[model samples]
Target: MSDVRQLLTSLQFADSAFPSGFYTMSHGLEGYRQARLVSADGVQQLLADLLLHSVGPGDATALAAAHRAAADGDIELVQEVDQRLFASKLNAEMRTASVRSGHQLIDLGAELIDQGLLAEYGERVRLRSTPGCQPVAAAVVYAANGVATRQAVASDLFAFSASFVGAALRLRLTDHRQAQAILLQTSPVMEQVTEAALERNLTDLGGFAPMADVMSAQHERAEARLFAS
Candidate 1:
């Protein structure tokens, strides 16, 4: 019964309609589209690359670390993880998008979960003591709600993939059917990434996708943009 409840909780948080502000960002797909770098056929590959080399090593790892820290009732360690993740982001746009969504998630987690830790963390975010990256905020919420560490990491990874594929749909790079296929095909990669993130040390947090960073930097200078990052 506890396992079932944890599954449901993970689903609720991972849902696209949860108002995490993920819809406002493209996860950097639009910038690639603008540069003519990706297409319908390449969408899955791009997502896989990101999971393997970027999001897995970076955000997902941070989520795993923060989740464990929160589970241990170590808010200071959680904040340290959050600060490290924020500093790892190379571009201002990526950092801004993360903090913007993070703030929203932390606020929602505080009200919805009604956990004192979340409330305390939210206050810290307000005071700018921590950047409140989305994954870390999610970590606190999931930990407080009894979601296991691995499940928490995997759920957030799926949410990120969904948001990425959703962005691909809006960019007209993929149809609805292809988008679903892309997500289905990426499951194995997600699983592998999740495992890696779970085992990753906080000192190793951050991704090395220089090209993605470059694309994001380019997107920042564009006169017109569809997604925030």
Candidate 2:
């Protein structure tokens, strides 16, 4: 029964339809497409790079740290993780998107679950006292709801991959089938990233994707963007 509950929680948070607002942000993929810096094949490489450098050591690491903190009933530590992850984002849109999604997750989780810690965290987010990055909020939800740390990270990573692939499809870089192929090929990278994330902590939450950061900064000023950064 515990396993089933964990699976359900993971699925609920990972679902693209969960109103996390993740669909609106491409995390700079749209900027890459607009500059012609990425093509169909390039999408796979870009996703792989993001998985390995950006999301892996950064958000996923924060998520793992936050999950453990939450599991230990350490709300202050979770908030610190959230703030640190937000600082690591580097770009305004990237930070905004993360906090926005994080708030949404917190709001939704407050309604869906009866966890006092989530409510307290949501209040902190609402007060603007903390950055409340997405990974930290997701970790709170997963940990508070009984999802294992590794599985929670894996679910979050998969959701990220899906969002990126969806962006690629909208950019006409890849069709539905090709998008699936990209996702399939990127699974191993996600596993590696999850493993790396699980071994890291808040102090280790930094990303090396300078290009993605540049694209995000550019995307903020792009005259015509189909997606937010």
Candidate 3:
């Protein structure tokens, strides 16, 4: 791909533009803020923690697995990825959020592109046969559209990390400059995270961020909320 085309693809999948419903998710940011366990620095650290332990190795890994499955035309493997993602995500709110967003993306993609495998799987998920996570669906679509699996996974990482940053923005936990600085700092290292994840097998994917899971669980029951999980 030309440099310009690559830049546009990157921008299209960017958190600010990608409409995978990430804007609606705070991923426990609400609970953490409510519990006073997060401030500006805490926001940065939480973003860091989420990126390193949760998203980078977890959802991003799931995306890579989905991409590989799609590339091989292995829908069964993709189904396994979906089931594993569904089961490993302990928090009810988090699981619901993932599947709900995935459903939206699938419905939208089916109408907009009709990209064979994508259209089929989107319908599959809609029919309650294949429960996919949004990141996985997005990665599969990206892979089918000629983007490399690694780049697709990398884009997924940035998208996942920025959701927290976006949440921090809305919660007043961090300002725009801090968010930009954090994203910029993580830019170079994103590849390392993506590569390690893409190199893994889907079924064995596992990550433990108990505090994050707990906070997400707590956010589900918060009397008031800014974002959905």
Candidate 4:
């Protein structure tokens, strides 16, 4: 059996009901799908590319940073990564998605988490002094709650993919069974990416996912959009 603290960390971060606003944010996949860039027939590859080219190294680094910052009560790390989030997510839509989800996570944490750091971060972001990107906020949540750096990053990655899968499900890109099949097919890929993410050094955190950036930029001006990002 897992230790009490480990089980608590997993239970807290892994729960989809933690109010990360994950259900609403698509993380650029919605835009790509609507643009027909990610066809229903090719969702597996799309998911793979997203994990590899985007969240695997990019958000994982931020997540790791957040985890450590939370551990040491270093607010500067959170703020630095927030700036990185803006620099890395070139598109307005993607940036908006991150902040929105992060704000929601902090809000939910106030009720669920024993720590008050996330709640304070949410207030700062709402006041426009800080950028409340999801990766950073999620790291705080997991780290404060005793989740390991590796586990916290994994939670972020899983949550990222799960949100896109939810978006695909809502868009009718695939039925439940098909989505599950895609997730299963992608499960191994998630593990591999997590491994790569674990091996990654802290300094190598930036990424440029061009297609995702373009899609998000277009989505910002997309006249009839369903999801936020």
Give the winner by TM-score: 1
lDDT of 3 at 198: 76
Q: List the residue pairs that clash in candidate 4.
A: none
Error of 3 at 173 (Å): 0.9
Per-residue lDDT of candidate 3, residues 1-229 (tens digit): 6656655675687646667788988888888888898878766667767767777777888888888888888877887787788778888998889988887777666665657788768777878887778777876677666677777888777887788788889988879898998787777667677887878777568678998887888888888887988
> What lDDT would each prediction earn against the true structure?
0.93, 0.89, 0.78, 0.77
What is the clash count of model 1? 0
What does candidate 1's lDDT look like per residue over 31-85, in tens digits? 9999999988999999999999999999999999999999888889999999999
RMSD of each: 0.8, 1.0, 1.7, 2.3
Q: In model 2, which regions exceed 4 Å deviation?
A: none
Candidate that scores best on lDDT: 1
In model 1, the runs with Cα more than 4 Å from the true position are none
Weakest 10 consecutive residues of candidate 2 by summed lDDT: 198-207
lDDT of 4 by residue, 64-93 (tens): 776777788877677777777667777777
Worst 10 residues of 3 by lDDT: 2-11
Error of 3 at 168 (Å): 0.6
TM for every model, in the order presented, reads 0.98, 0.97, 0.93, 0.89
lDDT of 3: 0.78
Worst 10 residues of 1 by lDDT: 108-117
